[model samples]
Target: MSQTIDNRQFRLARRPKGLPERDDFDLVTEPLAEAKDGEVRVAIDYISLDPAMRGWMNAGKSYIKPVGIGEVMRAGAAGTVIDSKHPDFAAGDKVSGNLGVQTHAVFPGDELRKVDTSLADLPVYLGALGMPGMTAYFGTLDVGQLAEGDVVLVSAASGAVGALVGQIAKKKGASRVVGIAGGPEKCRYVVDELGFDGVIDYKNEEINDAVRRECPDGIDLYFDNVGGEILDAALANLRLHARVAICGAISQYNVTGNVGDTGYAPRNYLSLLINRARMEGFIVFDFADRYPEAAREMAAWLSAGELKHREDIVEGFDTFPDTLLKLFTGENFGKLVLAVER
Candidate 1:
């Protein structure tokens, strides 16, 4: 900890178009700064790769600010506190926070939270034990107002948040849980492994008909992650008083246009009115303070083998840009993560 270690950082080099490419980010190395008073220096272990990061790369106002050109691309990461100058943190404490896309980070101690590796692996802290998990919890249980025996349908049902939403609904007593994934493999995993009632292979199947077939009666809750055609298809099957938790729009995140353009909007407004269903969007940060409460329940589920989490981790910080593309193409099988090496 005494000797200075080099920090490699990936900064936003320019605004991206359609989908991000390698040139959109610039990688550079610099000497790690010393931890000043009330600050801690962490040796980052893993970087979270999420579909929402694509939206943060654009040039517009969003739920979160865009990653400014030349700034380290904002990301959620976890690592060990190698050096600390604050009363609340110790040198050996593992922590999680907005550590960015870097090999090391130095920030105010208040910005990081201690991580207990005994509870889960560090990368799990970036996945099931992280924002994705919290989003699924509040979005399904609270926002979706999921009730016992409700029939639920969720888009991107095999991805990070969607996977949990489907399983949680079933555990909470949903009579049927149908998932819409991109392929046969993901569809099988969602159904056979996650205990969903059925799955629609959106990449190769007719979505509207499949949803109707899966939830013959009608869908009572729709947890949408892909917002384009899939959303419209899900809307077509909503039952009376159905609720749609708008967790994300990964399908539209990379859709860009001239500055100030509002981007892709779903064309199924009539369905919401006809069925008297509610569609609401949420940010996981809004429930930050309640994370511990949610994590405790999730841990119990994990301990009792009721919850399953999978991470598709790629190594090396150099693969940042290319690795991000895996999300849009649906190549990443689970919560994508980058294992950083120092």
Candidate 2:
């Protein structure tokens, strides 16, 4: 007999300006059918909430197509397979993929990866061992071209990707790992807990002043998460032959009106020419073939206690809209996950 399940989903109700409100999404329940050929039906357990999701909502050009107005809000999710017609997957297997925001997903088996439950928790797959982890790894190593003893600085240092970037730099023998975050608590976490060399609270101190004080010798590698003013500040303090990995620009995601020309323009563009530095932006999906290698190394680090992860799990699927706002507002700590089922 075929099984039918009621799936709850959040759809994009409207485009948002600044911080997204509850009205941006509509939650509705629908009946889900059995999986088709080469597909598996998954009961989604954990859904990842990322800062990048904000960019996906806007009607603009990007690495991927914007979510259509009536479409399900795009997301990364981890869950257990309930049914499968794919030869590679089976019932009860744990899988992770871009399943969007829903209680149930019919995922293409080719797109899903089987996860080892012994390595870490399910939320870890959506966070430290998933897209955020891979982003931190490739962006720092390939884009930033990090080397031993290089001084590394990261903005949004308390978020999922930034936290891992700092830790990975430390593991690679970085001389100084400095972080810039929003408040005292986050700053403290980056330094005291995450083993960063220093931290600056952007809320209290000016961005350039903060960078100047912490990175006196100039920054060799800047893993930029929050661009805008922070990027301009880091540009002014680049060391010779420095590399900047433009991972994201969270600061400018919330403007309601026209994205004005008044945004922070780096006054230190000459620094790149003077120091022979390189700046590059990257998407994690570009390194798809290399994910296994990254996952192996990151998993090893996690098992060896060299890598640490933190998750901010929000309960209730119905609160998806409200919960997503936490990332932009700095209310979420570590990797944010929403638990849809028990």
Could you say which candidate leads in lDDT?
A: 2
Off by over 4 Å in 2: 256-262
* Model 2, span 1-342: residue lDDT tens: 776789888999988877788888888889987788999999999999998898888876678888899899999999999999999999999999999999999889999989988889889999889999999999888888999999999998999999999999998889999999988899889998899999999999988898999999999999998778889899999999999998888777776422322255567778899999998889999998998899889999998988878999999888898899898788998999999965
Q: Relative to the true structure, how large is the alpha-carbon lDDT of every model? A: 0.88, 0.90
Residue 308 accuracy (lDDT) in model 2: 78
Per-residue error for 95 in candidate 1, Å, reads: 1.2
- Candidate 1, which segments miss by more than 4 Å at Cα? 257-264
True-structure RMSD, every candidate: 1.6, 1.6
Predicted candidate 1, C-alpha RMSD? 1.6
